[model samples]
Target: MNKLINRLVLGSALCGFYAGLSNAAVLEVQGEIRPDPSNPGGAQIINNTPVTGYCTEFPGMCGMLNLRSNTFNISFHSSGSIPVGHVIPFGFPATWRTFTVSHSSIPGETAEIQIRIAGVGTRYRLSQKAQEIVGLPIGMDEFYYHTTLWGASWVEATPPCRPATEWGRGADANGTDFTVFWLTPEDVTTCPKSPRYVIPGMSLQRLDVHYELRAVRPEKLIGGNYQGSYTYSMGSDFDMGSLNASDPSMTFNLNLTVKQDVKVEMSADRVYLAPKSGWMEWITHGRKPEKLLGDLRFFILSSSPFKMDLNCERPGIDTCLISNGSHQVPVDIGVSLPSPWVDDTGQPIARRPLKLGGAGLQNIKPAGLPNHLPSLLHFAVPQDSVKDMQSGSSYRGTVYITFDSDI
Candidate 1:
């Protein structure tokens, strides 16, 4: 009877020891949602406590959360604009221009959260004074703004937030004036039915907002200064238990300015004439004469009509005369205008070349000359005209080239 009692007591003790071992928690699962530092406008899930040791039971739950909670915050890090110096032509479509907006979020709990965007002032306009000067039509809008969810492939939002749809101007704005996008977990089965989910502790996810602007009536857009502003609110529908935090929102001011201007530049400050040996000599019977002066290259950029003039510094100095203090040799002057320059788009424009003549004010109106016109000037002395002149004399003269805008 004593032996039987001892065996029964030992069995009971062993059972209790096994139960205690099974109930002890080994690996604690703790994480949160937060913005990823490496990736702009993105978030990632971070483990609060270094995950170590092994789970003997329910191993999957060792690094997973079991409840939904609002433990995340959203903030913007980077913003970008359209290409600098990009000219928006009249009648340009909304599809031609785009601006990228980026933001990130931090989630505290391991549940799905919903993200929605709201904005104020969608249709921006130039200053009232500018509108009057440009004679903008009544109720004429200058720019139309739109937003879309930026995904691996841009996903078009439905109805009120449709792609390319105008976001009207206003102060009182709501979801009806914004767009909605989802930040889903890699394993859909882990957080099914949740709009956006994060691991426990601190998890971060990066996102992007695509904003596009289109010129409503570019024809009425006068060249001057113009500007506008707008406010955007990024709201998250997550249960923030007791933490007192402000909702994430941002305001962006949209502005643009157009100026009518022109730039003209000459390749060289002073032109040098070729040596006497390089000049066309009557002795070279059949060889063509080389030009006495090198071609002058002119680079012009203009948005309006312009004129170029070549004038001799001294009166009656058009012809080059070499004198040995007794006799003189007269070298007749010749000017050749450059051919019309062709643009990159294969457009042909005519650059009005001035006719050669004795020195005076050689006025040239380059009618039909396209912007960024590359022009050249040629100078020469007719061999026949100078054949009767004596040689062995020094000559010097000055010609001034001037460019004027006729806007």
Candidate 2:
């Protein structure tokens, strides 16, 4: 005799629900049963993974479904029309306008879904205008098909370069280094595993994308009338496709949502300073409010708010250098502060101005010192200042130290 056991499996029989309302529930039958007498010991089990299959409702029109039926099968592919225009340079304080695009299914059936955009490109900020944002180029497709409620939908596109100078039939079409997967809050919050895909840069801006649904039967209309059009910049780096379509089967849209560049904002968390004895007043200079490392006006200790600190070197146990009565012993003290800046065109740009105001300790006179022939000040600046900054640029400002002789 054969015996069977039950295993819990839920099959979404969406296809059954669509057929003429004479509904047959998609039932999951599970159990472990002994093999037939001829087969001996092993038992055969009924298993069910998500039932998936494809259907060509009519000639050249295809659809996919969780299960199968004669009249109703579901499937979707990505398609968009881009309006003719130049790709606007993405920048800070710029809002990528919320535009609507239409998508339809074959055979006039309802298809539930979400949307996402991907390609090599850069990301921009929406709060600063005229300031050049820095980032690599990665093209991003929007994700609206997944959201339960289509509030203010938008997908922020990131391309590799701002100038995007090279565009042609033969240019390298790789967008950004990383792949962007647009997910609903459910994708980010409900998933148990950490995302293997990186969003490329630390600062990613959000775009407002809108969606409209249309139902059309391919059998009735010979020519595929695209639902709607989106206005996108004219460039060769653009790649478009259905939300979850296979990679090799990517589709292209003529006019896409407004394509813009990106700006990344950053701030210094801490700073350190190293000053030699007799050197007072470490006059720093740079841009206002934000003293960046590579700004043409980049300098140490610019104006207000961008403050530098003067700290006496931490003395070890019984290691204070004693000074002679007449002449104060000259010693070196270390200085530190939080470093801050933004990335502009892949270059480190100052966000918060580096000031000489905080802690106001430019130079310090040591009470004493061991008679020395040659010596050097050893100190370290906060690593955060260097963390994320571009190369060839100095994050810390230079401080000049001067020692005073008792007059």
Candidate 3:
């Protein structure tokens, strides 16, 4: 009985060995490229290894024969509605924007990714009904790769050419191409360990590209909606031996539209008065000479040149006319303009006073106002002037503020 059991065990072991040999040369590679969830304008690559392979069935028995290397390539193509950015007039600042493309390959293989910009050179154009109206220059000079954010850094796939006319691609003045290389691991033990590699059991990689647009003289751009397009292609080059190679190359279109924008708003339509009696008391007692009546909050968001003006119908009659039947007394009015509001690192605007009776109209010409400007309104009556007024009299007038833009 012992001899018979040993024979059966031997037979089973031989059958397993033969099966491993038959499948030793078979390797299945799978993976996909997707957008990285944690980062905007970034991509992730995931590589999936086959479950039934010589390396899994007969690890030590197959030796190096079970070790095979495959190359996977992913190409990036810009699809419809890529991204759009606007250039404000007068060197107004704009934010940086990014677009992403991703690719995945078989696990445990070397990978290559190529980025190519194809179409009417690197110059972006303003189009009308598919007709080019104006052209703006664009190239690798205006583009940057986010290496630190992507975890794995990428080296220039090819040397830059002297007097490079276009971006990544070689001598071609109209087209550009660049490549990045990385390796996919066989398993978690061989995967790249980094904070960006959030998935522990999966082998993934990512890349990000950033871009921006600026207008030195926004006056040149039409003050309406304009459309443009960019053509790009991503091609992957790899070898899969007897298996079909993953075709990771594609062509895409990026549409961009620019719109002229300008806006101005006030915090309140009418400045409400604090109690009239309190104001009269303060003015009569001279308690606070520079007492604040209220603040006129002005908000301006413009991409064009503009000017603001303050006018009063009664500039010559610079008094809040209070009347009880036929009695009236004049109240003094004063306004102070703070420094011109600045957006980010813009130049500072000088402060000026708006004396209703002294000036014809207060003109505020800001080189560029991208933020809020608060003007303080103060009212008072000379101690002597209040003494001549009747006990119960009321006065009222109007102040007009106007904002004009040169688009």
Per-model C-alpha lDDT, please? 0.28, 0.20, 0.28
Largest TM-score belongs to which candidate? 3
- For candidate 1, lDDT tens digit of each residue in 292-364? 4344565644322233343443323443343334544333333333334322233333433332241222223
Judged by whole-model lDDT over C-alpha atoms, candidate 3 comes out at 0.28
Tens-digit lDDT track of model 2 for 62-97? 121111211111111213311122122222211222
Ranking by lDDT: 1, 3, 2
Model 1 regions more than 4 Å off: 1-260, 274-293, 302-304, 317-374, 388-390
Local lDDT at 343 for model 3: 18
The alpha-carbon lDDT assigned to residue 40 of candidate 2 equals: 20
What are the models' TM-scores?
0.27, 0.14, 0.29
Residue-by-residue lDDT tens digits, candidate 3, 1-407: 00000000000000100000012212232333332212322333343433222123333422432232222222112222212221111110112222322211212212123222110001111112111111223333212321221232222211121111222322222222222222222111111112222111111111211112222223222222222222222221111112121233322222212232335444444443333446667657854423223334444433333333434534446434333446444434444434453212343443333343324322233343223446444444445544554543444445444433321
